[model samples]
Target: MDLQLPRGMRDFPPEEKILRDEVIAILKNLFELYGFSPLETPVVERWEALSAKYSGGEEILKETFKLTDQGGRQLGLRYDLTVPLARFVGMNPTIKRPFKRYQIGTVYRDGPIKKGRTREFYQCDADIVGSSSPLADAECVQLALDVFERFKIDVVVKINNRKVLYELVRAAQIPEKFTEAAILSLDKLDKIGPDEVIREMVERGIERTSAERFLSGAQDPQAFKNSEGYRELEPVLSALRDSRVVWTPSLARGLSYYTGTIYEVYAKDSSVTGSLAAGGRYDNMIGQFLGGTEKIPAVGISFGLEPILEVLKEQRRDLPLRKTVTQVYVIPFKTLVAEGRAVCQRLRRAGIKTDIDFSAKGISDGLKYANAYAIPFVVIVGPDEVAQGKVKLRDMRSGEEQLLTVEEVARQVAQRLS
Candidate 1:
């Protein structure tokens, strides 16, 4: 029998896992620095919670991986973190208002896999709920910019509003029934190009001249001030004037729930084909969960972890790599295994990442192993050193050796690594 892994999934080995963890750590630290607290939700959610109305739209719903439990309960893996966050806020209303939270987790979607698209991927999200101020939206944009800046990735943030799209559709005289279809077609402008998008819209029963006019109007920011969407976006634009942001009317985000401002991030020079991150304000989703007419204003941005890593790799950025957790490798002569263990314990107690070779291999083989793992230091515990209550510490990088007490070795390594 041949064993195989599923398509569009991956196994992150040690080196890749370390790089991934480092990315997560950097994002977490930045999120915390921006006063966002961390929160987590279960991977599996009830089917109803992820249906079209709450999730995004019919397109996203179709891509959700639906399943049934042994008890015949319908469930689905969360396609995105925003829907779960809305459900969480609704279930726990006593939580503080204006809640700020960040979540990093894997989300699954059953969709056509491509270079940057996959069935399972990690999303790092930061959101602010219960804030109606456009500052919340601006902050989300700034946070995304900061993340890319930290990685030294040049990016251009495209901003738009759903209300603007609606007005543009109205301006185009696209019939009410075909509005969603037209918007979806427009959303593909980046991928399919203007000509194809116009062709698609024309095929969808929209007038060619009207579609052309609408596309032209969208490119000019001055043409949108009459729109309520323009009014909503004015403050956000003001807030982000110092950043690399542009009003991209063509960015529809392909989400039905985005009631207000929306954003998408693109790498300026990257081999990856899609946005690095995207999100928007969904003012009514939380209200749907509460069964109330009152809206709970919410805004968020999610980083596409896999695509960001791909871009970084393509750019040849240096990523952290350590084959083992051991900062120091302790090798003992055949007779000094007990002493090696004791030394290892002391080093560990002192917060040093220490490992000992239990194979009782020759010193040459042990040194080879240490070098293979790129361990910085190696401690040799042999008969003479044990008798003197000392150990020989070899600096792997420098090939220098020194005889010192175990405590002295620990102190020196700790200070040097620190």
Candidate 2:
């Protein structure tokens, strides 16, 4: 049988993995800089825990992959990190209020596989729990902007509030029961276009004229400052006034948990479509985990690592690939293998990344291997060099060779790399 990876899965080779790691590191650093502590949650969650009620809404629930363990316990791979976070907050009341945390991990979904969408992907999430302040929401937006800015990627953050969406729906005379459905349909405005979205709203039991009116209101942010949604969103806009954030009333995030501000991020110019990151306020989700009576104000944003990577790749904005972690390659002549090991050990002890080639290949082959991996330095230890207690250090890039003591070689290479 031929070996093949499952559909919608991916194998990240060394270069790709390095880029992914770099992105995650940047996100983690920014999250920490913004006062968010690191957190982790299990990949597998109880099916009951991730049902439609708590885990966003029916849309996400439908995409969740369900399974049964040997003990007959029903479980599902987590579709998103936010649900697990809510569960954690609900179960751990002892944790200090207004808990702020960031999580970076892989999540699974059984949805259709596409360009930026996959069955398994990484999500970097930062959340503030227990704070109703719009500043918290603004902070999330700022963090998102900071991440993209670091990448040198131009992006626009579209901000909206669920309460504002509700007002628009009410103005359209769309019944309250169809609000969720209407928002879900509106979320696809960019993809399906206005005509299709209006048809969807009509199908969802909203009047055609009302649907058009609601969508028109979404296009005009200034028309609804006195409305509840805009009133709630005003502080957030004020806090992020210096940012590239815009009031996008049509951006009703698909999640059912968002009770207030919702946002979606997009690359300003790129072939990669869809949001790079998105999140919003979910004031009632944690309370639902506790009992649905208590209201715990919470807001967060999750960076879609996969889609960001897609954009980066399309734009060719990637870090230089280091095929090997070894910064120095030690190549020994036939009988000087022992000396090579000693030199490698000395360099490593000095906190330098060093490797000794055990292949016993000639100098030509050794240089070939080092060059292939883009290793910057190659050390040649032969009888003459060993007797002199020195090694020939060759700068792979410049082809410059010099005889130096082991310590000198280590120091020089470290300095050059640094």
Candidate 3:
């Protein structure tokens, strides 16, 4: 009998691991620079904690990998970091208010294996909790731009207000009872056409006149210029304008926790509906688990690592390839094993990423492996050179060789690599 891994999952090979680590380092550096400290939550949580917190779509409910733990407690793998963050905040209210945190980890779902969508993958998230002001929303938007900028992906940040959508429903005179369904339909405006939205609204019991009013009026900025949502969010737009950031109003992220500002990032040239990154204001999310007593306003953004990688695969010229960190590999001839270890130590002590070919592969094969791994330089030690307190250094890229003492070799390699 043979055991095999399930579908919609994969094991990352060395090259992929290198690339993924590069991405993680880039985001981690930026997250720290932006004042977000790191926080990690459990990969599995009580099912009730996740499912009960948000009234998300049927897909999330059904796709979650649920099972019974040893204690007979129902548990599920986290579908996303946001919900887990909310649970963390709820469980630890004594932590400082307006907490800023960043999390990077794997999440699981049961979606079909496709290019951007995956069953199990990683997500990079940064969130600011305990603030409802659109300034929080603006900061989230800025964070998204910063992450993309570090990755060298040019993107347009799209912004919208759920409050504005609700106000539109009220303005259209849609029945109060049918607001939820109307909002869902409005969320799909970019997916389906305006006509299909009109049809959904009708099917959802929205009046014909109200449906027409929503389709026509919701698209006009002036129509919302004097509305409540616009009034609350205009200052945020003004702030973004002062900083010369382009902000659009077409983003309606399809999630229930988002009560106010919603946003997404997209490539400037692509028409793909899937967002590279997205999040929104969920002021009442923590309160959901905390008995709705304390009002903790919050907003956040998450980058879809897999989708961003896919975009890079398409835009190779614009993407920077991950470079190996090991700067030098010390290779010793058959008789100079001790000198080889000494050379590796000297280079490493000097703050250069150095390693020894302990496998005792011959010099030719060792050099070939270094070339294959893209190691920039090689230090070759042999009996004669070791006796003279010198080692041979070869430039992997140019195939140029020179003999220098160990100390001098380190200095020479540093200059060459630099």
Lowest summed lDDT across 10 adjacent residues in model 1 is found at: 316-325
lDDT string, candidate 1, 38-91, tens digits: 999999999999984756788888889999999999999999999999999999
Would you list the rank order by TM-score, best first?
A: 2, 1, 3
Which of candidates 2 and 3 is the stronger one according to TM-score?
Answer: 2
Per-model CA lDDT versus the true structure: 0.90, 0.90, 0.80
**Residue pairs with backbone overlap in model 3:** 131-297
lDDT tens readout by residue for model 2, 1-418: 9999888898988878878888888888999999999999999999988994856689988888899999999999999999999999989977897899999999998888888998999999999999999999999999998899998889999998999888888888888898888889988899899999999989888889988998898888787878888888999999888568988878888888889999999998788788999999998889989887788899999999999988888777555665767789999998888888988899999998999889878999999999988999999999898889899999999999999998999889888988
In model 3, the runs with Cα more than 4 Å from the true position are: 1-5, 53-59, 195-212, 242-250, 270-273, 317-325, 411-418
TM-score of every model? Answer: 0.94, 0.95, 0.89
Whole-model lDDT, model 2: 0.90
Question: How many clashing pairs per prediction, in order?
Answer: 0, 1, 1
TM-score of 2: 0.95
